[model samples]
Target: MLRSLVRALSGEVDPEIEARVRAVSQGVNELGFDKWGFSPDAVKHAMGLYAWLYREYFRVEAFGVEHVPPGRALLIGNHSSQLAYDGIMVATALLLEADPPRAVKAMIEKFFQHQPFVNVMMARSGQLTGLPQNALRLLQEDQLVMVFPEGARGGGKTVWERYELKRFGHGFMRLALEARAPIVPFGFIGGEEACPSLVDVKPLARLLGMPYLPITPTILPLPLPAKCSVYFGRPLVFDGRGDEEDAVIEGYVEEVRSSIGALIERGLSERRGIFFG
Candidate 1:
């Protein structure tokens, strides 16, 4: 049924991508849901749906995909594009490009739960609620968890603020320390140009209970075809107890933030043009 639904939504599912997705070890139950609500079927469907955007539309160039180590790992990334397409692209790359493909379990905002169908789709597609416990549990289970330390602030950036990472929260650092997971910092470029926000309507966002209400030239959240690039860095491990002073934790967070920032700069230097690179 899910395959049929996926075929209906996207008539073009790459055979190689399909084989790679099936090779992933999600450990789902008979009903197709893992303990944390991951459905292999749903993930495959999502891959089919987003594969086009990742390929023909955005023409995403993924570098250092092999940097993602096996077993437990924390993927820290810079977030942008109000719609969170950066996360989607990163996940897609890991699933399609990595050797012995991995299905990344991304931590998402709780605010999305209020939306109707979007909520269910997210959970089934292996996205977890952005809570400390959820992230810790996934790490303990040896799953690859993607986290955006900048949270909604990074996602709501205006065009001018693009690639300039917002202040990163220290919670992810604490989780990594606790789980003994290696951190893979990555940077995503071109989302800001894809859906550049001219301004954020504060009053409207407050009323709607959203992070930010962006006003773009499109007037909608649709992303333009901007050449996207994701640069994955080597895994970083910090040695310490998870229970550390606030200042100590902040240092780890800063290190990861700086690494992501450097990646962004590298991508910028290599980019030939926003729409062509």
Candidate 2:
């Protein structure tokens, strides 16, 4: 019955898209649910909606998606637009544009887990809790995992602070080292302009148990139709055991951050305008 509902919600899926999504590894059980709650059917159903946003609304242009090497890989990208559309676009590009469609297991913030029904949606859509253990397990299984090192700091960026990367957390770097997975740094441009924020209301956010409440020109941070670009760089490999010293881990984190910064700069230079692509 539930499966029927999912299919009904999906309506008619493109046969080519259905084939590509089925090609990705999902590891579901008889009931079509993976141990982590991923459902290939659910992912397929979601592709149509996100694909429209990727192709039409945002008009996202992705480059170097081929850099996403097969097997275990860590995708690191900047997070913004309060709503996390950047992550969606990045994941969509990998699924729709990569040579072989790959499912991205995004590491999600704990704050979102508390929202009503959000946990179920996130799991069914192939997202996992942002825990080191979960990410490690995915990497060990040769799955592609996506992480945003900037966390809430980057998500709360105001218009004035757009494109400026906040301090990165070193956990992703250490995780990559431990899993022996290559890190692919990608930069997402235009999120700030899409959902420009003027200020973050910390007091309100605290009252609501939210990370930060952003005040945008539209009052809500709904994304405007902004042309966005995502640039994927070559894979980066670091030498060290995952348990390196804090200083060593910090250095490695800095290198990845710099790579993403450079990618962002490149995307900015290539872009003609916010809404003009």
Candidate 3:
């Protein structure tokens, strides 16, 4: 009622704003207006918007999305760039290629949930709590769960540090083990180099409460025109192992890191032109 009244009083707001509002409302409905949540339809709609925005802003080419399996799987990929365009591209590619059109959910950082509007979009896009319980639930439902095991540091790592896989968190391995899901290792090239941030702006980031503000090279500094490739390696299956046992999960994590690293290296080496060219 209040929402309707607000909309009515606004007298036909901007289309983009309306769409975003509708997306948020849909998320509220699906999440039970609770602490945090997600909906497949809302996620698909949001992804569509992102794909449209990205295509208009930059030339994006994606490959190996066919490698994503139909059932439940954990997508562990290298995190690059302070911005999340890497994940966005991967999600878009999966949407375009997955048969039956699987809904891909990502375990996003907790900070994104702090913003009212940003949280709505993230939830609507099926980006649930990066918490263990939420992750376990999504995987059990047989959903494709995307995660940057390297977390915030890896995602925002400097360009020179791109493709250098950081020490990944073991939560993914635990979740995979608990849910019996396969770990799909993938990598994105050109994301870190797309909009490289040279220095740490801790004070500004703290002021805005944003993890990091990116400093890229394009007008509006969009992701570089250099071709972006998303390469997926064979899925790594997890045996039912005890979570307390570090050795088993460690071995699996190493494999995932190595797989992603190899793909990123190959993608970088195969590039036809320099990033700024």
Candidate 4:
């Protein structure tokens, strides 16, 4: 069981894998089990690695954790870094740095979810697609749901559009209205510099049916060591039926977007340097 969970989360392992497996397995056993396909052992192992990335490598400083209310809540943020490092950092902050240490169910892109190894690992880590049905169900169960409204567009951003937000989908807004979950907006600083997208080959991307293909300097499958900071804003709540008009719901979406945008600007200003915070 331990080996399986580790394999699902990480692609490779070595002699030290046994020690990690033992540690995570023990932690999972103490918690019993969960219904969301969440492998506590997998989460434990992943969190341990992310904690190091968040605390030491990037030297992250998280703020406004208190804004996340109890029960079901929507965590919306500006996504960048060419990868899901922004999402992982947000999850790490709440899991290891928050007052009560809450678990977040991140919404994964359907296209990316089809990858051979990523599929199982994402499910075992309790991440679900950003579908209305999935978000509603998770919120109904009183769980924290994190989403990047910008979706693939945000992840594929070029260097110039780093902090600039793209058009957001109304799906998250509708789900929040249906679940009556408050929205917690967050911003991640220094992520745009971590992997600057210099160019995107549109022809190749179209052939592959992907949004955009970003080409960056970091050739290796690793993010350059860069300092990071995260800021969570006050939660916002909207009273509306899920069937509301697009225009009406968009008003609320814009508000959340604006909040996150402001946080991003503030974080960028506060950052001391790119690699050193």
lDDT of each: 0.87, 0.88, 0.70, 0.80
Give one digit per residue, the lDDT tens place, for model 2 in 72-120. 9999989857787888899899889998888899998999887778788
TM, every model: 0.94, 0.94, 0.78, 0.87
Backbone clash tally for model 4? 0
Output the better candidate (2/4) by TM-score: 2
Q: How would you encode candidate 3's per-residue C-alpha lDDT over 1-277 as one tens digit per residue? A: 3454444344444454334434333225543443345554455445445555444333455556666777789999988767677888787676554554555678888888897888888775667768988888877777789999999778667666767888999988888888888888888877776767676566787798877665545554355555466788888886775465788778878988888898888878777765431
lDDT for 22 in candidate 1 is 75
Tens-digit per-residue lDDT, 1-277, candidate 1 = 4554456376565677768877874577889787877777777766776776787778999999989999999999998688878889999889888898988999998889778998898888888789999999999988899999888898888988888989998989989999999999999998889988999898999899998888988756578888999999999999887999998988888899989999999999999999985
Locate the minimum summed-lDDT window of 10 residues in model 2.
1-10
How should the candidates be ordered by lDDT, best one leading?
Answer: 2, 1, 4, 3
- Report the C-alpha lDDT of model 4 over 1-277, residue by residue, as the tens digit: 3454455347443334334433323234345445656776566666656766776777789989888988899999988778778888888787766656677899988877787888888887778877878889889988899999898888888888879999998888999898989999999887888778898777898899876788888873578878888999999999897889988998999999999999998998887888974
Candidate 4: residue pairs that collide: none
Question: Could you tell which candidate, 3 or 4, scores higher by lDDT?
Answer: 4
**Candidate 2, superposed: residue stretches over 4 Å from native:** 1-10, 219-221
* Sort by TM-score, top down from the best: 2, 1, 4, 3
